[model samples]
Target: TGDLLPPLVHLGAAAPSGLVRIPNSNPGTPETLLATSFNMHQVTRHKLTLAGASFRVATTPLLTCDDVDFHPTDILVDADGSLLVLDTGGWYKLCCPTSHLWKPDILGGIYRISRKGAPLIEDPRGQELAWRHVPVEELLRRLADPRPAVRHRAADQLVSQSQRTEEWLDDNFATRPPAVRLQLVWILTRVGSDNAVTCLRSLLEDDEPEIVTAALKGLSLLRDRGCLEAARKLLQHPDGAVRRNAAELCGRTADRSAIPDLLAALTRTSDRWEQHALTYALIEIADVSALKQNLTHQSASVRASVAWALQSVAPDQLQAETVLPWLTSETPLLQQTAQLLTAQRQDWETPLADWLQRQLAGGGSVSSSLLAVVQHFGQSEHVQRVVLAAAASDTLAASARAALIRGLGKSGRHPIPQDLTDTVVSLLETSHPELLQALLDWLRASERSAAFNRRIWPKLLAIAQDDHYSATIRLQALALGGEERPVLPKPLFEFVLEHLDAEQSVPEQLAAVAALREGTVSPLQRR
Candidate 1:
């Protein structure tokens, strides 16, 4: 519940999942210039990104830059849990100082930050070990050293002897703890050799989901067909993450072999996003045979997933027989899934048109899924009547009305029908930002539509000039009005001119510049 502090200057590489030493470089005395704030003091508190999470460290400076000449360049964590900071910034010149005071001194110092009573480190660098001629086994043991510097250096040495490393891993990988094994897994995957793949395959059933998922991720890189059995078994894993990683691996491998477990998992899995991952695996396999055959499977969930898969990856091959059951099924989720499929294929026009008519006649409510698909059906007399009626309804929800407007614009089916012109232009009368944005987006796409006639210009100009609205709304209005670079009448010219001085947002200024790019003033006004 405190103010968000600005970032520390010149932060170093991320540490191994804890607070590590780092520097605040170019500590030019506190000042602001050109909107850049240089507020480095001999003081600080900050958050750092470590392993994809932000951690706020002690809200006070651990060690202040007591001397202006001391700017730390790097920080290292010793095995004893002390931080060794390298202050090499003393020798370099940091320009752009607002104070006009600068110092250039060739002086540097190494400073250590440590707890008052922490134990002393033993073999911090394994100095007593045989580094000049260390054995591979010794290096492997050091991979789990309490010090990151020690572990990484040992890993580098071990990996250099690839032949012996792989042989040792084959016999001894399981003896290590999860943390050490995780490191080994990443190193093995990076090598990705024949023996490495063979070793990784055995860990598919590791007690740790992380270990199994990491193994699958590594195996997936090679699209190794040998792991299909492992992948198939893991598809039914209880952990959603493991299941997802396994599903991705299965998809990448694409074995012609059937994965009935994949369909079974789809029936049982409750997470919608995870179901999508499983369904994606089916799509990648694109087993035209399995997808079509499974449409008759007794499990409603499997049938829904199968029908959706065929429609997604093999739409033309998706027979009406395959999708019809779910489209007309009493199960609401299944029917909605099928209805969504209609938005994808032009051949499914009848279902879409009939649904639009129902939305108009059945009252104004639209299901979230159904609303997403309706805009794709806006063309021809069958669509225009219902879509226009929805757009013209002041009582209909704003989101539904906005969607209908989007549909009409996408029809790209030209020549605004004279009868529907009023309803189409009527879209501009609403002040709701979503509806206005949808209309402008349509206008941007259909620049030559007769709907953008003399009547549309004034409303477009007013929306662009209004400051009471948000920047996004104003930006869209400017986009439609600016698209043609029209020689605007004087009042219309002033309308677009007012936006030129929008100092804060670069986008608003750019919009104004784009509107004025090539056009010139008319002679009638020039006189």
Candidate 2:
């Protein structure tokens, strides 16, 4: 009853419609929907790179609303994979007032499409079986059912019996297939009882590494101190997956004793996946005193990792003097991470501009991230010089040049220096779109001066007069030329006013409107 609005004369949907193509009157309104499905992945394999994801691709779609105005508000999948579609794009005016001027509410359809040759599935909601009173053995067998709804129902009932769950695990867990065994560990982990924890501890000795890794993952979430020793032992497991899971478990438990093993693992593997887990564990534990003691390690990579972990633990203790060795190093990760760490100190902003200038003067290799640091935080006379130097260079990359100019535009803390006016004017010949846009943004941000009128005005007038440039750029040029000047250039106002006709494109006309709003007009010059 709350959805009401006065009648809209320009309703985009046509009446007498089951489904019709919606008109463009209300364009670009996004639709939101609800969906029903569970994670369909089996627990048997550990190689699925996207952990805890439930997405699957089917070779053929169950139904498609192609060539129709079809937007469904909700979708449901039945036990046999049949799809129920609720299409409401036709007559349901989402929030339009419940008006009597015209009725369009009775217009959507509910559709169901089923697989042709598949066997029928009985709905569990029918409750033919007394689920709680069902025999324990039958419930265990149903855990292997093909339908997710059935398997979930069985687990929901079996989770209530801790003694029975433990007894079944001691007697029959090994003989079941790996998939079923993994499922038992998952179900017990949900109970959060003594028997559940004990059952998980027993499986840590299982012969299969994947089974052991799965147990480690569950225990990590439980975060029991009793399993800390058990998790610590797998830190050097021959399998990388086991090591990763073990590192994560130690991190979650916050065991101070596991720091040594975590460090050893970090220095041993060059694999980024292993490095990520080990680094995450160290940061989670956050023992800065211990992390600092490892700085003397012989491997530069290990030292760099420790330095990063240390700074992350205590951001205030960072000294750029100690870190410059890494910021200037050949190792890409160390240099990039060091840039992020130094950028935290806003007092160091001018120093960043100095560093860039020194690099430029020496003709040394400049990392892209270091350049970004200078551009993002730097706002000084040195920054103006850096932008001017980068702009005129033919050897510098286009993106690097653009970043410097953008930094100048973003410098609100410090005044835009007048020294850059000539360099900004010389950019008139830049053919790169990104550099040209950055220059325009800088011009718009800078405070106008006498130098702006004498140097920048001429180039802007040329751009406005030359037809080679797009109309949008030309109109922008015309607007920028007279924006701060008390009197609009006679030639500039005359040319634009003459072309304000139906023959110009809509964008040109709109840009002309913005220019007219900024510039002054003389009563004597009106024609």
Candidate 3:
């Protein structure tokens, strides 16, 4: 035991483990010293030295049980010569693998030791008991105890009183058994809040499948926007399970951008169970084109998956004479499948658009499926019908208006077609702030002749005063006024100056300054 001193000193073992240092207050000199340690016999020793000569004291044996182990974790000695030792449990080595033996009596004991002259004085059991500080390992061992009561007590200590929660997580999160880490992720994420959100996010990329699942489930419980972003990034994860979880999260949020990534995942990954989960999520988000090719898969399950996805994409598009046979069977799955084939008419853009045009003519609102059809058939006559329908409905009006603005703005130096202008202006007159801004943008396009500005000045002035509009729109109006200059209002100059001097955005401010100078300085005069 005494030969252990050199190795112990080399390891700084004599310098108390888990000791807290308090600095001395005297100016220009080092301060008070307090050191504590717990010996292998479960005896705690504390030393306090002030101005150079101080007393040393220790606690008595913390445990009296026979055949007890002597691994202790912490020690502290008080001014009254009372000692405290935290008896941690012991470890055992087997031929196959090392194991642990948790001794409750050693961990539960507290002792007080004293020194009389040179020899030590010890009481196995003292009247006065030092505060018991149990090792966190012991508490965690209790969490794994067969007895429910012991597990509950240890859990309460870990969660409520001890500062060992971090220690528990650090110890277990990296190397513990899969099931243990999984449970820890759940508990930590629930009780940890934002603090735990990061830890769980890290576990999302963990190697173990069950650990990743547990982390994903924990993130679901968090419901944080950052967590959602993390999940979105995981849509590209190499692991199928991570990709599947990301798809599931997108379904829960109904985020549209996730559509493309989920589509890609469904096509590339072959895991049937995960594929099924992704298929279900795709259906919820109204995006099914991803599985379109799988409609002819030899496996019934794969074929069924494709069938459902296709039905969602263009149900009527499949209704044509040749493909309709697929849906003719009478089973519930096949009946729904047939309805989808009829909906398959949606697959071929022109027919679906023509169908949507007829539906519009008959006074029915365009279905979302039909709108999807319109997206594929960019220039069909249904475009004209959709324009007309949007001219009629309030919400559809802006989309109708945006399509027109984009189309005309893209058309360069052609004759100013009256029909295009009339359709645009009519839509623009009733358009929202976005539409008004888009129209002004089209009129001022350097690609188009400065000619359109002469026709649109009145509408431009009307939108400039629209304080409900965005600053970008307002700035655009100022630029249009400066560019056209057919008539410049006093407020236009003041607005430009205000933007030039006060706005922090450099581009807009520079544009405003240039516009203000250009409006005041006539080019003809400079020439």
Candidate scoring better on TM-score of 1 and 3: 1
What is each predicted model's overall lDDT from 0 to 1?
A: 0.63, 0.63, 0.50
Whichever of 2 and 3 has more TM-score, that candidate is 2
TM-scores for all candidates: the values are 0.51, 0.61, 0.31
Cα lDDT tens digits for candidate 2, 1-527: 00122221221332312211111111112212223111110001111122211111212223344423444545565555565666554455444332223335545566776667978777633256567667777877877766666776778777876556665655646676665666777787887677777778877877766677778888988997788888888887777777888888888888889988888877777656566677778778888888777766766656666766776677555455666545666677667656666655565556666666666564434466555555554555666777678666865677767766777777654555677677777886677767776776676676666556566777776777777777777777766764554456677676566557778888778778767776556786554
TM-score of model 3 relative to the true fold? 0.31
User: For candidate 1, what is the TM-score?
Assistant: 0.51
Q: For model 3, how does the per-residue alpha-carbon lDDT over 1-527 read when each residue is reduced to its tens digit?
A: 00011111122343244443332212122222233332223232233321111122332332333433544445554433444555444542232111144434444444444454633324322223222476766665544443333444555556564345665554435665454465566567646645567778778777775566567766765654566666767766665656666667776665666655665665565555456666666676665444555456544444555555555655653344333433334333433444444443445445544544454454334344344333333343345445444544554445554554444344342334333444544554654766675565555542333455445556656666677776567667656654555535666656766776663587668666555553334454334
| Model 2: lDDT to the true structure | 0.63
Which residue segments of model 2 deviate by more than 4 Å?
1-63, 67-69, 73-76, 84-113, 122-126, 130-138, 205-210, 229-244, 264-276, 294-313, 322-328, 342-482, 486-527
Query: Can you give the lDDT of residue 409 in candidate 2?
Result: 75
Q: How many residue pairs collide in each prediction?
A: 0, 2, 20
* Clash total of candidate 2: 2
RMSD of each: 12.2, 11.7, 24.5
